[model samples]
Target: MSTWLLPESLADILPAEARRIEELRRSLLDLYRTYGFELVAPPLIEYLDSLLSGTGGDLNLRTCKLVDQLSGRTVGVRADMTPQVSRIDAHLLNRAGVTRLCYCGSVLHARPAGLLSDRELLQIGAEIFGHAGFEADIEIIELALASVRRAGVAQARLDLNHPGVPRAIVDSDAALAGASEEVYDLLSTKDVPGLRALQARYPGLRPETTEALTALASLYGGTETIARARRVLPALPALHRALDDLQALVAALPGHEFSVDLADMGSGYGYHSGVVFSIYAQGWHDALVRGGRYDGVGKAFGRARPATGFSLDLRKLSGGLPPAGKAQAIRAPWGADADLVAALRRLRDEGEIVIQMLPGQPQRLDEFTVDRELVLDDGTWKVRAI
Candidate 1:
């Protein structure tokens, strides 16, 4: 028998790291609760149709699938929580007007091109359904920003964009409808040469459409870059609306570094109807959080509600963050008394790492394998140094 190992992209979370992740999750969840968002946990597996209802392209490819033996139908491991949550809002919750929901869970998916991480990742995010206007969009963006800040992501930058740039092009031309997916991917990567080849193949398209496509190609930079982009597509109303929405969002997040990426930078999820954004920290090349508005996706599942939310890649954040706390041994005195057990239980309940001594074993802080120590002496509990 060959014993090579587990897959390279997959990994296990050790005790210390897992504990830190759980602590971070609890802290963020508590913060989200303060903002009136109720938490929900959707099942990790669902009908393939429900999970892929509005998710598209890269997301669909990343999903892991299996056939249910009992039902004789295909089901998929949830690759992302947003689509699952959207399905929940549509089918289960069906909270007619509007609903605010948050979720924290692990998602499994195939790795995407250029992505270096595991197929299984832990995510924490929220979805706001049933609000349609720009005001609603702004609120979601602000919350996404605040959530990242609360996670101790110092020097976080928000990059905002709208899928409408390509949507406008595709909607204006009947021939482009089926080709929108290919065009969006090319534009997102700023593949100007490939875009030009597409334009050449579809010469009947309007010059304005080509200009919009070309403008989108060179639209990545800071605030001044956005202004420069405005000049390139001065007459595109959709572009202007997206720009205005971004401006308002930036204004709301004053003193926080924010920029507009006019490129076709959004995931091609059919549900994302308006502005989309990603958050990045100083040293990480990938976004720690990604979210946007998906106002019409709920409609496909039978309810017509507007929705927006974001997910934090917990693994990515943990990798980038400093070590949670210093490592040290934990010690606790051993005694044959009910009070000692009660105190040990209380310490464990409070989330302190503790080690209990065996009978006849001396309690030395250094001998215990934990961060802190507790001593029970004369009906009093004291924390001792290792």
Candidate 2:
């Protein structure tokens, strides 16, 4: 293997793609600011326990751990920034009333999350803390939709779910006391046979319970899916509340595409207590954004608050986006003339990218295209388009 070869699922973003990513980052962060979300930058690494605390087993598996040489305690690179931002809200700021926060940075995963995903991801997201209403969920979801639209997706789909739907049913049944993971797996995969077999393990379980669980796997579509769910599912209070929440979102957000999948909440839905969602586009197989309401995400930091947010994989979102318009630069000959130097500085200060030709340098096509040039035409230095 070559010494310069990168590890599996890790690679560099060359100039063209890097420019697009940077432009999109600036645009999205500015959007967040307009909504009053203050930007925050958390450390790239922190103590292992705090990083993994309250995030559940999936986050632990993805985190890359190492020992701190100075203190000998274990530390881990962040695989996700949401938890760290939550800590800032609860411990650092500790402010009363609602707090809106946004962040963008690189996170390292022990392994790639998907076949097409990189181990190192550029994650950007916004969170709303201290507000528990569906209004918070709507605001975050709208921001997510607006983000992808700005990135060049013509039409987007929002898949909504509530982990509490399954949790409500599972918690009330004594037979499923220790088999929560098994049931979640079966439902998420839509494995009817496995669900039936699990139900058979407890011979005295009611037939209605088994039927309801099996039906959830196929409960998906547009607004009609929500109606079908309400009619088919059992009448538990928790389940009713979950369905009502979905209904409220649909009512509030009109003209947006939506689908409901009770069985497929999300990767971290086991730990996420309320509404969960993922955004999809035409060509992408995986979600471009994933987030939901995880009310107590800050409990480990000592101040629990209602928090909801969504994160976009910058690499994933940048895939089909149009390239940013390159600035028209004036290529100048390498010289120390006072007038030329002053003009060059003035052009740079006015937001133009001026490429200075170095002595003995050969013009390369990959470097840049000369749209204009500075020359002493008729004894006056002026910019002329070629």
Candidate 3:
């Protein structure tokens, strides 16, 4: 194999895409700051147990594990930062009131999430801990919407779901209670045939369970899907409460396009305990953002806090955006003269991209446009348009 050959789902980010991703990181992180979210940068790797704490089996499969040199213990390259941040909230800060935290970093997934997805992603997100109110959920969703909007995304649609809804129905039956993972797979993919076959696979499976699972698959559509769920699904208390939570979320955010999918047991970390959501826009093939309330995410760390947040892959977000324009620059001749050096420093300090040319050197720039030249105009260096 060629030494330069990269992994199947991993590739180098060229200058153009790298620039756009950096710009977006600055913009979105600043947006989180405006909302009082403190920025945090967790380590790239940690002990497997600490890294995967609170998050369940879903993350374990995605995480890349290796034996650590120092301790000889299993360590995982994080595929998600939310759990690490939860550890910080529970163990480090030990705060009493609401704590809003935000982070942006590269996460390595063992495999690509989809046919065209990358194994490495620049994950950026914000989380609010210590608040269980719907207000927190609303803030996270609105911030998620604002992030794409700030990036100039248009016609973005929001899809809402409560894991509790599907979880309630699954937990109601013995056959499904032990087979939740397989059942979740069928529901998430809308495999109605597989769901129907559950009865034949498990003798004495209730007809009501099969019918409810089938109906949940079609229970995705406009906001009306919530009301339809109430009328069609069984009147389990847990199911009703889940429906009520969805109703509250919809009522809280008026004038936004929303579709409810009752069958989706969130595919991420699997710690979602309440309202969950995803953001979909026209340019992306799948959801651009995913997050929800994972109230007890910190419980494993000895502190339980109500949490809600959303995250998007900056690389994915950048891919869908229009190509960024070339950054403007000023071309300068190579000189060590005191005045010339002073002028160069001044221009650079003033946020100008100044490229100093070497004698007989070829101009090489792919990400910048040099439209101005710095010349020694009658002794004093000055910049003039080319």
TM-score leader: 3
- lDDT by residue for model 2 over 251-302, one digit each (tens)? 9888877888889856672458888999988878788899999999899999
Alpha-carbon shift of residue 2 in model 1 (angstroms): 5.4
What TM-score does each of the candidates earn? 0.86, 0.92, 0.98
User: Which tens-of-lDDT digit does each residue in 340-383 have in candidate 1?
Assistant: 67877887787776666687866544322565668765768877
lDDT of 1: 0.76
Clashing pairs in 1: 130-306
Model 3, residue 377: distance off in Å is 1.7
> Which pairs of residues have clashing backbones in candidate 2?
none
| Candidate models: Cα lDDT each | 0.76, 0.86, 0.91
Candidate 3 C-alpha error for residue 224, in Å:
0.7
Worst 10 residues of 3 by lDDT: 262-271
Candidate 2 Cα misplacement greater than 4 A, ranges? 197-210, 322-327, 365-367
Residue 244 local lDDT, model 3: 95
List RMSD in Å for every model shown.
3.5, 2.2, 1.2
